[model samples]
Target: METAALNPVELEIARNRLESISEEVGTALIQTSYSPNIKDRRDCSAGIYGPDGMLISQAEHIPLHLGLMPTMIKNALATYGADRLVEGDVLITNNPYLGGSHLPDMCVITPVFWQDELIAVVANMAHHVDVGGITPGSMATHATEIFQEGVRVPPVKLFSQGTLRQELLSVMLANIRTQDKTRGDIMAQVAANRLGERRIHELLEEWGAERFAQSTHALVGYAARRTRAAIEQLPDGTGTFTDSLEHDGNQQRDVAITVTVEVSGDELFVDFIATDDQVDGAVNCSWAVTEGCVAYVIKLLTDPTLPSNAGLMEPISVTTREGSLVAAKFPAPVANGNIQTSQRIVDALLGAFHEFAPEQVPAASSGSMSIMTIGGFDETTGQYFSYVETYGGGQGAMPDQDGASAIHTHMTNTRNTPCEVIEREYPLRVEAYQIAENTGGDGRYRGGDGLIRHLTLTRGKAQVVAGTSRVTTAPWGLAGGADGKPGSVIRHGPDGDEHRESMTRFEVQAGEGITIQTAGGGGYGSSPAAE
Candidate 1:
């Protein structure tokens, strides 16, 4: 596949240049987006792909987004062949069956052309605030079907021949609750892709197409070689483990997600056949998410610093039962799958890897994103509002150091919405935000502590929907370390009474409040029993 020979030094420079372009695209999306989900929380990702739909470089964004980006690109290419994609043409999609995490994560694809020859594809995925659903925030916990979650967008041309599809845009905006912000966020993604297109064209002009292709091929090969070397260091055996979701929200039953990782020679295989069948709730995930989770853990174990591209996944193979919870079929609600089940997949992978490489894998993180959404009307403004948030809990302890506290770990890498911003935007008051004491597991190096966020409604009625897990099964410890405390969502009524709830949707009257207590990381290393 070597079109032209390039030395190692030259290859490194080219790699950095491509990666820098992706980083710039990500920055453009964040700076231009209007929603706090994209702007403040930074729930977005950007990447550059080759003409054949292979990921070349990506920005340091959400792991779930980056890992599944290639699939998204390939699906577009397959639906509308490469010959159909011309300069100034862009594709938009959030179809869960076609390489999408959920409906809210809209992906924009633009083909970069130089001298009328297609050279690359620049794409980005951003979590829109709303896409028209029964729920206010579009994250319905009890959604039994995909249609109940949000609007479903297949791979379609949002822009064709340098012209905006105004009709298409208008229709999409008409369905969602937050039309203005959603429109801004979509255009922001377009802007990011356009910027990436210009940068790629400039790179091609500077180095010529042959040199650019040669350097990218060389860079991918280098990453593959590094990953293979890392894989060869591990023992040849199979490690199996099982972790679970306490409840799927549809029924009050535990859902187990199991994995068996096989490492042989320079190849690694991850199988998810031991998991439970897909439930009728919103926790089921598409196959793309399951594959992405496998690829993510392999990268974590082998060479996290290696170039994040398709080549790094060359030696890894994934297998999943078609109708399992981790690989759910069509029409299954997956609103919480991407955020909640994805975390449990990582935990299962870590559990398996701990069998042979305990030092390489950290103990379980707070095994949930702790999603909390409160939506209601602001009588002061006479407009409907939905406040959606995912809180960071404790990070699992490492063998050499203590875990980090109050941080987003694995799959999710988003910034927190400030207390001031939440209160300013919504009719809510920041009652108390503090670190929950005695939450982390005790060990030689204790796990990090979780946090508590208590918010009170200033006025009007509201509906609270929470999608969370790890309430019954605590984040497990390693090497005899103690287990961390379980997390819970508590409602403090107007009469001063409090109670715990799980995956629930209820009404909150004025003066009522809710408190979210996230879980802490499990400790690492053997220690005596705690008093």
Candidate 2:
């Protein structure tokens, strides 16, 4: 299985084929999914991994999901040994402590076999709408422990040798609020993995297992060389920066996140050991998530065209303190950590990188996902319905170009759920959806404007959970630019307008509505007028 015999052209072709397989898997999942979260918003990711759980290639999907997939698959494989896994078996898990971002994000893994030998594995993860929690949506802002957030599923066999585990599936669906959507999405994941398996088998048929393995090994090594070369371009330096979370749902404010980046030779080291301890609310993220955020910033700073495989991570090393905000322990609530904290982590890292490479970094963006979840009984359908969505915000402005307005930036890459879909599916109405005027900071290159979305209950009463950031601490500006405007949430009801906290859970009546105003991005440089 020596890769020395493989030529550059052949290796490039193999790389493209593998990447296409991952992209095809993602397409299959989105097309077959039942929930709007996956079908319309495309909040899902797919990847192909080697037999040893090393990432080979991934689709250009969510950055957060792509980086964490390798860790999740490796954990699953370690939990359930290869001897226990069969050809058609699919493993599932959403335990944050066990290498997952949150409880709602479910990962499905399938092992590909060639003549009784395990050669590769394909996996996909999707954010299910709801998974049995104290609140209607699984992301409870006030939830202090993981038990209250949602149903926790550890690494287990969802399918055994092409047979679905009916009893286990039944138990899982019984706990979730949107049973049909969850079930359908799970099946869609299975379908995606199945397609990946079939495609890999086709490749193995064309080229023997030995050649296939050799090509994959060669691709990974090539990516490693490219990443190291990119790192060598940066001057050796150490940069440190600190950022804070305005509030963690449980009244804790200014939860600090510190990062120190060191570039030596062709290697990079990111240390988060100085970060604050885990809080009492749902703002805590696991070590895998912290690593994912660091990996994302590394890719952006180094080379965006680098192949997204395990090799890309070879020249980078990350260290985080155990039980810290960026590396929470078991039993800590983490629903918002994946969406909210991840954004802040990216901002902190970029801020540190700016110290050494100011031209390479951009001003901070809206720095929030603006997640909104509403759930209750649907009068029209006579069933329970839960809707979950992450609203896009201002994108950070670059040195030479203006930022994009009302777009998903940094860690998230999801689309906004269409207004028509919300009105047609759930007991809610999209009263208004537009960009916040003049919100982006003014400079040589202005930052992007934030979004304003207002939603009203259409029929029955519903419970709403919203988590946001950059409310108290505005998105920071760089290179003498101005700070972006902060965000705010309000409830418009019979009692008039009432401001809400950064993280809050409330009930809304049929006539009541909620309005979310996201933060804008920081400017890149001082405006000509100011100059």
Q: For candidate 2, what is the lDDT?
A: 0.90
Candidate 2 lDDT tens digits, 1-531: 455556878988999999999999999999999999999999999999988798999999999998788888888888878668887889998988877899999999999999999999999999999999998879898888999987899888999988999999999988898998999999999999999999999999999898888888898889899989988888788999999999887774898899999889899999999999999999999998988998888788778898899888899899999999999998889999977899989999998899887888999999988999999888778788998999888877889988888999989999889999988888888989999977888888888999999999988899998888887778877787777888888988888999988887799999898988999999889889998
Instruction: Give the best candidate by lDDT.
Output: 2
Candidate 1 segments whose C-alpha is farther than 4 A from its true place: 528-531
Query: What lDDT tens digits, residue by residue, belong to model 1 across residues 1-531?
Result: 753666778878888999999999999999999888888999999999999888899999999998888888888778878889888999999988877888888999999988888888999999887787878888887898899988898888999988999999998988887777888899999999999999998898798887778877877888888888889988787899999898896766789999999899999999999899998889998878988888788878767887888888888898899889988889888888987999999999999988877778888889988888888767788777778788899988888778888888888888888899898888788898888888998898889998899988888988888777777779988887778888888888856756655577777887888988889999988764551
Deviation in Å, model 1, residue 353 alpha carbon: 1.2
Give per-residue lDDT, candidate 1, residue 83. 88
On a 0 to 100 scale, what is the lDDT of residue 321 in model 2?
98
lDDT of 1 at 408: 87
Q: What is the TM-score of each candidate against the true structure?
A: 0.97, 0.99
RMSD of each candidate? 1.6, 1.0
Q: What's the distance in Å from true for residue 490, model 2? A: 0.7
